[model samples]
Target: MIPALRQDRGQAFPIYVVMVAGLLFLAFAFFAVGQASATRNGAQGAADSAALAAAQRAREELGLRFPGVLTAPGGLDDIFKDEGFVAAARDEAVSFGAKNHADLLPGGWQPHPGRTGQFEFTVTVQTQYTVGRSVIPGTEQDHAKASATAVIELRCGLPPGSGGDNAPAPPPVTITCDGQDVPVDPLPKLEKIFTVKLVD
Candidate 1:
């Protein structure tokens, strides 16, 4: 009876070990799925940030900083017409994919004007990320999709010299003594009055 009990105990231990291993494998799979989802969300957030930054930069280059300026009202419209906001958004989508590690998806842009000269451009970026194929065996293919929309508005306060009438001041003139003759700066005033006779 004692010998039989020992043999049964050895068999039971192996079975218990196998069950524990299986449970651990399942737990690891669950963790992997959660991690993949988090990573996908992070990529989407990055895409949103990038799109907004690009739009802001484009608007800034177009001189859309001030609201009350005569050009500010139509500044975004001008940008959309001249620069093509939709195209810029598409470029941004590609950039986001490279920078954020996601597959680029469909997106678009729309121009909307706010109170006063404030202009806003709505930009949307969409992307998908593939995550988790292990543990589920046949369910290896899964995609997480995300979409981000941003409203980029022109900043208030006109930049320096934006509407100001102050032209660049005239350059200063310098006179130097060159031993043989006094050298005057090349200015219209000096050029008009001074004439040189060359002996050589």
Candidate 2:
């Protein structure tokens, strides 16, 4: 009886070792998956932030070019046509991406095409980063990237024109944003019309 018990114990030890090894492998796999997901989310956040920064900078540039109250006659051609506009946007995007621990890919900064005179300036940014160390075999280094877009609009309305002597003076056109009424002739405040959102 004693000899038989010893043999059974030896068999049980090998089975237990195999089970523990399998569980360890599964745990490592789950850890790798979680790390990859975290890296991807970080990359996406960096892209979104970078895109917003680019769009905000562009909006400020437009505001500077069109300071004060803007009438209907003026066009955005000059602002868009400036050679430095695109460069400035790209620089801002890269700067923001670096701040978020990501690097902007080559030619990752692009202005939306076929959008002219709409005051809808859109900028897309792609960013990539490496995960913390290499846990998974052949996956020690992974590239995670994402893109985002932002838009800026001009909000205004034409006041009714006075008719004749009997007609009362037209009320001043007002611009309100985020619940605050903007001054009728204040300096260009794109914050009132600018909106940043993640599109991808």
- Which candidate has the highest lDDT of all? 2
User: Each candidate's TM vs. the true structure?
Assistant: 0.53, 0.73
Off-target runs (Cα >4 Å) in candidate 2 are 68-72, 75-84, 113-129, 132-135, 157-182
User: What TM-score, to 2 decimals, does candidate 1 have?
Assistant: 0.53
Q: Please write out the lDDT profile of model 1 over residues 59-162, one tens digit for every residue.
A: 44444322222233342233334444445555564676557666554534444543342334444444354565666564346655555544444322223333
* Residue 163 alpha-carbon offset, candidate 2, angstroms: 20
RMSD of 2: 5.9
lDDT at 75, model 2: 27
The worst-scoring run of ten residues by lDDT in candidate 2 lies at 156-165
lDDT of each candidate versus the true structure: 0.47, 0.60
Give model 2's TM-score versus the native structure. Answer: 0.73
Per-residue error for 110 in candidate 2, Å, reads 1.1
